[model samples]
Target: MPRILLIDDDAQLGEPLAAYFARFGLELHQATRPSEGLARLREGGFDAVILDVMLPEQDGFAVCRAIRAEGDVPVLMLTARGEVMDRVVGLELGADDYLPKPFEPRELVARITTVLRRRRAVPADARLRFDGLVIDPVTRSVERQGEAVELTGTEFELLLVLAREPGRVFGRDDILNQLRGHEAELYTRAVDIVVSRLRRKLEPLAAIKTLRNAGYALALRPQAHG
Candidate 1:
């Protein structure tokens, strides 16, 4: 059974959600305090986490960043705010997905399942090679043209997103949502920052072009037609 840690101060919602998840075969562990939740995470062996944005001591974004610094466990953040900034901030902090408040229990289940599916789909081979660049998803390492290139987790994920859909122009919001593991943020240039960082690393091999207010595109040079 997949084990999940749910951290939410809202007992009214958390209680019922815990019961609902149990019926789906997930082993649910609930923590109403941020400290307790972080402790449980450190104890290890959790398949995923459902973290609420609002908390008593520490906010969910802080917790998300803390966990991300330690590991890549899939995180699905819960927020009653539903504002674009809230969603964006959560994603920037590395939450895998976000669901607004008043959501149906069934929808939560679906999101959890989706995150798990993506995790399972990630290549076991730690390294991915495309053209001249090599990416190690596990260590979050990247190499281009036989040279090691440093990339932040978000930058690496952004590259992976674009490479996975070659020739596709990913708008800022789409790219944000993809790497964010959830919704887009409002009035934040996180995606732009990620792109700028990625471009610097990719410049030695390929060109990462901006589409004039549209978003970004990684244009692969045409192979010589022999």
Candidate 2:
């Protein structure tokens, strides 16, 4: 069973939600406060996190940043229904996905499944090597110039899509489709935010190239192997 941590201030949301999640073979844990949630995460063993934008102690964005700083645990943010900025800001802070409040329980389960799938996606080859970068699909790890580059689940998936086919320009829709494995009501700018973060992590190498009016491509040439 995949363990998930939910950090929401709603005292009533956790028990029922956890019960519903159990139907899908997911073990859902709850924390009514951000501090409790962060502490549980530090002890590890969670596959993903469900975070609500409105919380006591601090907002969800701050928790997302703290989560990203520590590790690449997959994060699904719960936002105010129809609030675009909430979703955008969560993504920018390295959230793997977002669901609007007042959501159907099944839809939330589906979102969690999608993110977990993306995080555990395995490529055909063992490792992808570029001029100054290396990606090991099995380990879901990346190295830039032989230095380990920690990445969020979404970031790693985006880079995998581009790195798998070097120099192929992927449109925003194309990248989104490949990454999400389904059509979503997300903005194309989401891709740009992820790309920006990825570019920063892969600095000095210019591993990803952007084409105006198009999408992004891997700029690094494959490292020759003997």
Model 1 ranges off by over 4 Å:
122-127, 130-132, 136-158, 165-167, 171-207, 219-226
Q: Model 2: clashing residue pairs?
A: none
Q: In candidate 1, which residue pairs get closer than 3 Å at backbone N, Cα or C atoms, i.e. clash? A: 96-181
The total number of steric clashes, by the backbone 3 Å criterion, in model 2 comes to 0
- Per-model TM values vs. the true structure: 0.71, 0.96
Model 2 lDDT at residue 150: 88
State the C-alpha lDDT per candidate: 0.74, 0.91
Residue 74's lDDT in candidate 1: 83
- How far residue 5's Cα lies from its native spot in candidate 2, in Å, is 0.7
Write model 2 residue lDDT over 69-125, tens digit each, in one string. 998899999999989999889998999988898999998999899998877767677
lDDT of 1 by residue, 62-165 (tens): 98888877777888889875476887778666666778886888888878876776565555554556667766666556778788875544566678787655
- As a whole number from 0 to 100, the lDDT of residue 172 in candidate 2 is 95
